[model samples]
Target: MSGVYLIGAGATPVAEHYGRSLADLASEATRAAFAGLPEFAAHRVGALYVANALGDRLAAQGHLGAYLSAAVGLRGVPAVRVEAAGASGGVAIQQAVQAIAAGAAEIVAVLGAEKVTDQLDDAVEAALALASDAETEALHGLTLTAQWAMLMRRYMHEHGYGPEAFAPFPVNAHANAAKNPLALYRFPINADKYRKAALVASPLNMLDCSSVADGAACVVLASERVAREVAAEGVPLVRLAGVAVATDTPALALRADPLDLAAARASAHIALGRAHLGLSDVDVFELTDPHGIAAALALEAMGYYEPGAAPRHAADGAITPTGRTPIATAGGYKARGDVAGASGVYQIVELLRQLRGEAGPTQVDGARVALAQCLGGVGATAATCVLVAER
Candidate 1:
């Protein structure tokens, strides 16, 4: 398999907009993504890969592959729709890797898009149902939030980690979003606001949840040979070092621990091992943070903390953008809005910006190696990727 490089990426300015479907937003941003790059105007795009979680449910934009292909004017190329629940985008990239490695394609365009605001109520309910085991968990009347709430209680009882330890997670994301021009929730959320916010499910508050949003992002990938032929010096080329996916038990209650993200930890270990890098070698981190607790659990499962101590690390400001390790500098799903399948790809897009030193105000200084992790439905499924700047 040939090495691949992420040559370009573009995202719609994150905002709350009405009556827009995910495909529409994706097409709009993808067109702009290619149009803005004069250097790649003549380059041949061999395939189009789209990561969409909600296909016909929220906006009824069915047949995303054909729709986006025609919309982006990349006719006659193979178009693939990638979906792994919330980790759809990351999995889409994983497919792109195999395509490149197998000589099936040299250039792939990956897009992650979601329209959650059109039918906010249904979207919320549908997203929650993703936490279920479908045959079992869904029949048992479980929503993602409900599962997390129960898991949170279990973690609290098992490890003495309370709601207070998780408070800083969302608060930090909101504060970080305040600095991001494209973040949906730009206002600051302090400890006072955290204490007073209405509880959606006991420990999880209204502020703890992500807002409904409609947006899209796209990235262009080319073979290593093509990157050397086209890229400029200042524009750092990020090579996809490794990618891995793992799935745990479907039912949260049936897993090793409802609060533990076994799949995420396993996927990260595999990806980092393949990349020949360790936890300490990653310079930037971006996670699919649908809730504050999800972020804490992923960090702990990924060896960032010792089991129940993730909350304490987050509370001590160890996970903030300016802290020792930054997770979700673009505010994650908590501030960036959870767009289901799009969340994982969006995290990769943001990390590309950080690696290229093009993140503007949110840039992580001196970042070289970057890791992005996305968990699907209470850690039942997960995808992890490690990328490094091409020297």
Candidate 2:
């Protein structure tokens, strides 16, 4: 297998692009990604991978790989779409890396785009519900927020805590987002605001949930030889050290422990191992936080904290960029806006910024190794990747 390196990354700000189609958003990102590389050749792009979850339901479009490829002027390349619910972007990255490693493609383009805000409120809810168990959960009207709220309630009961304990997750995310130009919610919030926020579901307030947004993110992966050529031209190379994906039972009711997040743990463990590193070696983490409780569960499951203690870490400000385990450095899903399939790519783009020392205000000083993990359908699927800056 050959090594793969990220040579370019780009993203559109997470917001309501009222008149932009999915292809338009993706094309903009792709153009930005190629803008920095003077040697970029469209014909050299051997394959195109597009990640999206709701294009058909929300945008009335399908075959996004072909659509986006042509939109970006890569019409004849082997193009395909990757869908794994919320983990679609990360899984797309995983596939791109594999293609480069296996010599199937020397240069691959991965684009994750989602148009989520264009649909009606009820239609958006229905499309999101497709990520959950259709027969058992969605059929019974178990919306995504409700499932997360149930988990939060159970977590509070088991840990003897209250809803306020999870406030730190959103507070920290918003604070970080305040410094990120591409973030949707660029204002900080206090614990008081969180406590007083309107409830979307019991124990999970509106502030605790990620907002739906429309956006796209893109990254270019190259073989070791191509990466060296790019680096020779002064482009900073960020190595794709490791990547892995894992899955769990689709139905939450079937899990032995609803909050375990076994898939996250498994993917993180494998990715870290492949990177020849440990938890302590990771300088930054970009884990999914669609809901505050989800962040807590992910932190614990990824071994950043003891089970049931992640909330405490958050409350104590341990997850801040200057803390022991800095997470959500780019505002994360809570405040950055969750564009569903595009969120994972957003995380990777943020990590690349951190690695390149380009994260203006949200930069993690001396950050060398970064980990990004995205979860799909509650905790049913996970994709994890470890990246290292060239020394």
Candidate 3:
């Protein structure tokens, strides 16, 4: 297999693009991705992988691969939409890497775009519910937030904590997001505000939940030969290094431990092993969690923190911008605005910025090796990638 490098990365500011269509958002991101790189052109892209989870339900459209490829001027390119619920974008990236590694394409474009705010809140909630198990979860009115809330309650009960234990995650996210101009909620928040925030579900307040917004993120991935040809002097080359994806039981009720993100652990460990690196070698992580509790659960599940310690770890400022395990550096879903299916792509874009030393205030100092993981529907599907910056 050939090596794959991220040749270019770009994203639109996460927000409620009230008038923009899904294709428009995707096109803007695609153009920005290729903006400073003259070596690759839109027409020259060998394949296009589009990730849109609610285009059909929210946008009232389908066949996003062709629709978006043409919208972005990649006419006639072999394009297909990748849907793995919230993991769509990360899975799209995984597929793009495989294509380049298998010599199926020299350069492939991965675009993760989602439009949710265009519809009503209730409508969006129902659409998001579809990501959960239809017969067991969604059909019984188990919304995604409710699923996470259940996990939060169980974690608190098991760990002997109150509802406020998860505040630090979002507080840190908002603080870091204040420096991210592209982030939606750029203001820093405090525990007081978290305490006053309205409840989305019992134990999960609005502040704890990620904003449902509309945005797109895109990346241009190239083969090792193409990357060498496009290399700019004095700039570090960011390689994908290793990637692995895994899935768990779709229904949360079937899991041995509802809080155990089994797929997340498997994917991250497998990818890290492939890169021949240990957990300590990672400088940063871009983990996809819908809220603070999800973030806490993800950290523990991925082995970043011991079980029942992630909340306290965050509370103690261990997950800050300069801490031992910095996460959600680009504001994450809380501050960056969760564009659902496109979040995985956003994670990659943010990681690329960190690797390039251009993350501004959210930059993890001296970050070299990073992990980016995205989960689909209450941790059912997990996609993990190890990125290495070669100086």
- Candidate lDDT scores, in order, read 0.79, 0.90, 0.89
Better of 1 and 2 by lDDT: 2
lDDT of candidate 3 over 136-200, digit per residue (tens): 99999889999999989999899998988888988999998999988999999999999999999
In the range 1-391, model 2's lDDT, one tens digit per residue, is 3388999999999998988888788988988788787566455899999999889999888888888899878898999999999999889999999999889998999998999877877888889888999999999998888999999999999999999999988998999999998899999999999999999989899899998799999998899998898888889989999999999987899999998999999999999998898999999999889788999999899888998899898888888988777887889999999989888899989999999999888788899999999988897889999999997
Pairs of residues at least 3 apart in sequence or in different chains that clash in candidate 3:
none
**Cα-based lDDT at residue 317, candidate 2:** 81
Could you tell me which 10 consecutive residues in candidate 1 have the lowest summed lDDT?
Answer: 34-43
Pick the lDDT winner. 2
Note the residue pairs that clash in candidate 2.
Answer: none
Backbone clashes, each candidate:
0, 0, 0
| Candidate 1 lDDT for residue 383 | 92
Give all TM-scores, in the order shown.
Answer: 0.95, 0.98, 0.98
| Greater-lDDT candidate between 1 and 3 | 3
